[model samples]
Target: MNDAHLHMLVNHFPIVGTILGLIILIGGVYFRSISIKNTAYFLFIIAAVFTVFSMSTGEGAEEIVEDMPTIGHEIIHNHEELAEKFAIVLYLLGVVSVIGLITNIRNHPKATFFSYAIVAIAAVAVFLSTKVGTSGGEIRHTEIRSEAVNQNSNAASPKSENNEY
Candidate 1:
């Protein structure tokens, strides 16, 4: 398959994974379960790895669709910008997670501190993921765009009899 297809396939995991990791991490922290915390850390690392794949394929995907009738440069540009920001956050989360995992494994006194750090980073990652995901969806899904939806609704409404064409 082409880069565009590959991108579609892999792009979702980072967003979904970060969200899942955040939830699981919260549970781990609440229960004080090292194993669950490790699982969440692993998921964050995997999500970060997938971000590389997604970003690498994104340019190719843009090239293939940017000129399409409804998909323009502006929408793709927005998505690209948000994706970059989200990727940075994900990378940071991944690094912190790895350190957290290592500290936990060694029974370091600061392990709990690392868990709190991960939670904060993951929260930021989750926020960015929502923005990136929405921007990416808007690139291809014009119906979901606010302006497009408003235009559609206006067109559907009947004009007054006094109004002339």
Candidate 2:
């Protein structure tokens, strides 16, 4: 599949999986259940995998959408920047979650501590992802799209060849 298609398919996983993981993590903590906590840890791992997929397809996505009429270039720019930030956060959380899972399987003493720590990291990820999602949504949403048009109209310069990659 094309990058844009892959982007559309996988982009939702990080946020949605994080939310689902958070719910399970919270439940595990509240109920003090090992099974539930382990499940949440696995979910975070799955989310990490999706994050990789999203990132891998990003350049393809950018190439496809950066040339669309209106704010396509601007939206692609913002989305690229935000995606970079989001990837860093997701990678960190994913690593922490992996460690937490490994320790849990080994019956390590610090497993619970790492789980909570990963949860905290995941919370920050959730916030950043919301911003990313909002910026991405603006790419095509009428209100933001109109704003983009007006802002660019003021400049009224000849459209330069988009060199974004």
For TM-score, the strongest prediction is 1
**Candidate 2 vs. true structure, TM-score:** 0.83
Tens-digit lDDT string for candidate 1 (83-143): 9999999999999999999999999999999999999999999999999998988887888
CA lDDT, every model vs. true structure: 0.95, 0.84
- TM-score of every candidate: 0.92, 0.83
Best of the candidates, lDDT = 1
Separate clash counts for every candidate: 0, 0
Q: What is the lDDT of residue 158 in candidate 1?
A: 73
How far out, in Å, is residue 149 in model 1? Answer: 2.8
Residue-level error in angstroms, candidate 1, position 116: 0.7
C-alpha positional error of residue 120 in candidate 1 after TM-score superposition, expressed in Å: 0.6
